[model samples]
Target: MLRRRLGVARTLKDFQGQIYGLNNLGTLLLQTGNNQAAAQSLVEALEIARSVNNEEAEGLTLSNLGLVEFARGNYFDAIKQYKAAIVLRRRFRDPLGEANTRNNLGDAYLAANLPEDAAIAYGLALQLARTTSDTPNQFRAFRGLFNSYTEAGNYPPAFRALNQHIALAKEEKDLFQELIWLRLSAQLYTITGDLANARSFYEQAIALARVLEDTGEEALLQNDLAQILYQ
Candidate 1:
């Protein structure tokens, strides 16, 4: 049915409608694990976008192609596509697009085992997200930074990025998520030899666990907190 509509749009030479349909169908195909079909649709969309000189549409199609390549484990290909999209996004003055593409580029860099590059990309994404007041993307950028730093064995920076994520997440007031982040914060602090901070986080998690009536988690946190205090 969707393809039929796309066919109609194509036959009518409805450039805008056709491109939108193709991009949407491509995304749906990717979600369903039909990478080949997704790529085909996206390729057609890219051709149409380029032919029509629609940089924004071209950038979007390129970004979708990046995801297809990433899913296929072609990190370099994904990076190429995302970089292309970023250039177009920047040229078009699309902060949101640039932020998203930069984040995707970070993921590609990370997948390519280039944590430093990933960190750089994620840092840029974070700044862009912050500038645009895009809270969700800011959270995503911070999460990516945390992972990138962790992968690079840079514990302090990783902890800082993760701490920012926790701060932002606290606004959501998801108790279970809070408990999890507190536990992770404690672990990261322990790794960094920040015993006092570790103890504080562990204590926080323990109290939350008690509130949630999670006796097992409470016991674990208490034991960990005790060990930290003994230090």
Candidate 2:
């Protein structure tokens, strides 16, 4: 309806509007696990954003690029894109955008085996979330921090961050958030040689993932569980 009402002529003239459509399309494909299509659409969005010198749009497109890289397990490339997105978002004074990109940057760094760098990014993301009063991002940042610290071998900070994330997820009544946090906490515990706690959280995560019908999350947790069992 919006596109029809706007008309092709007017929409084409509005670069932002055109990019918006591309952005939505790309995001939809990304959600459906179509990395190639998502990357194509995201690149188109990036071109439009660059043409208009729209900082916000550029940041969004870069973030989307990071997602594509992550899907392909190109963690270093993902980190670069996410960092670029964060810089653009910060320059635009878009706290929410900065927070999101920071979270993605942290994830990319962690995937690249740079946990200390990931912790720094997650810390910045947490600060941005607090500044913006974005509860969801705050929760996400906490979880990111937890994982980063755990991977960095900073057990105390990791435990603290995990507890904070779990508390926030409970307050938000976000079962999915809780489930992910549980899985992460479980892995941390397993790494620290706390098998009993690891098993407990793994069971909780598996149960919640099953209920949500999230095959991706289920598979990830299964792999983690298998590793824990192996040890």
Candidate 3:
């Protein structure tokens, strides 16, 4: 269908339709792990967007291109593409797009082993996501911060971010995810020698696991709790 649209759009010389068709196709390909094909389609879309001054298409294409680069392990190139996309998204007054692009930039930074930079990008993404009431992206930003800070050994802020992430999981009523985050929080606290908090989080996770009927998680959490208690 997308290929047919691309064909029709090209025949009609409808630059906008061509851009949209190409971007959609590229995004679909990217999602399916066809990075090379995705990049080809996106590059063509980007060229057409630039030639026609289609700012929105250009921005969307750039973001898709960033995903391609990230998938290919070209972190620096991915960061560059995301930054360009973010600037265009911001200029077009698309806060949601900008926020999502920033989150992508955070992931690229993390991939490049730049935890501090990733933290900064995630912080900006969180603020933008909150402004737009994008709860999912807000959750994602916190998750990124949790990973960034934990990797950097910044335990206090990492724990704080993990707590917020878990709270958002509760808000979304995703009990299984909440249990996962709670167990991770317990581990983080344990790493920091905060046995009381570790035990508390572990207990909370155990209770939640029981509620969810996840016997395996419950058993694991109980064992972890026992180990910490022994220490």
Candidate 4:
């Protein structure tokens, strides 16, 4: 369907439709792990967007390019692309796009072991996501903050961030994500010697997993609970 759209766009000389089709193809390719093809498509899309002076499309394509770089472990290059996208997003007054790119930047920084920079980026993303009432992005920002703080050895802040992420997951009714967060909370509590909370969260996670019929996860949570009990 997307290839057909691209073909139709070409036949019609619809630069906008061509750009959109290429962008969608790039994103789909990336999601399917075809990074090389994704990069090619995104690069073409970016060129088209630039030619048309479409700042929004340019910013979005740049951000997708950053994702490709990030997936290849080129953290520095990812940061550069993300920053470029962020500049364009800000110029367009696209708060949500800027916030999303900031979160992506935070992920790159975290992967690069730059916890402080990751924290800063995630903090800004969180603030922007809140302002925009972007609940899903807010959850991502908190998850990033959790990883950043944990890597920085800031346990208190890390737990706070995890709690926030869990709250958002629950609010969104994302049971699978909530179960994951619960297990993470349990592990953190256990590491902190808060055995009571650990057991409670593990039990909650186990129960939730069972309700969802995720036997693998339920078994994992049960094993974790058993360890906590023995400890």
lDDT of 2 at 209: 96
Q: Which tens-of-lDDT digit does each residue in 1-231 have in candidate 1?
A: 888999999899899889989999999999999999999999999999999999999999999999999999999999999999999999999999899999999999999999999999999999998898887778778878877887888988887887788887788776876787788788778877889889889989988998999999999898888887877
Off by over 4 Å in 2: 1-12, 173-186, 196-231
User: Best by TM-score, which number?
Assistant: 4
RMSD, each candidate, Å? 4.6, 3.8, 3.1, 2.1
Candidate 2 residue pairs in backbone clash: none
Model 4: runs farther than 4 Å from truth? 166-177, 226-231
Worst 10 residues of 3 by lDDT: 171-180
Predicted candidate 4: what Cα RMSD to the true structure?
Answer: 2.1
- Evaluated against the true structure, the overall lDDT of model 4 is 0.91
- Give the Cα lDDT of each candidate: 0.89, 0.86, 0.92, 0.91
lDDT of 3: 0.92
Specify the highest-lDDT model's number: 3
Q: Indicate the residue-level lDDT of 191 in model 3.
A: 87
Query: With candidate 2 superimposed using the best TM-score fit, by how many Å does residue 145's alpha carbon deviate from the native?
Result: 1.6
Alpha-carbon RMSD, candidate 3: 3.1
Which lDDT tens digits does candidate 4 get at residues 1-231?
999999999999998998889989998998999999999999999999999899888998999999999988899999999999999999998999999999999999999999999999999999999999998789888888888887887899988898788778878889878987888789888877899999999999988998999999898888889987987
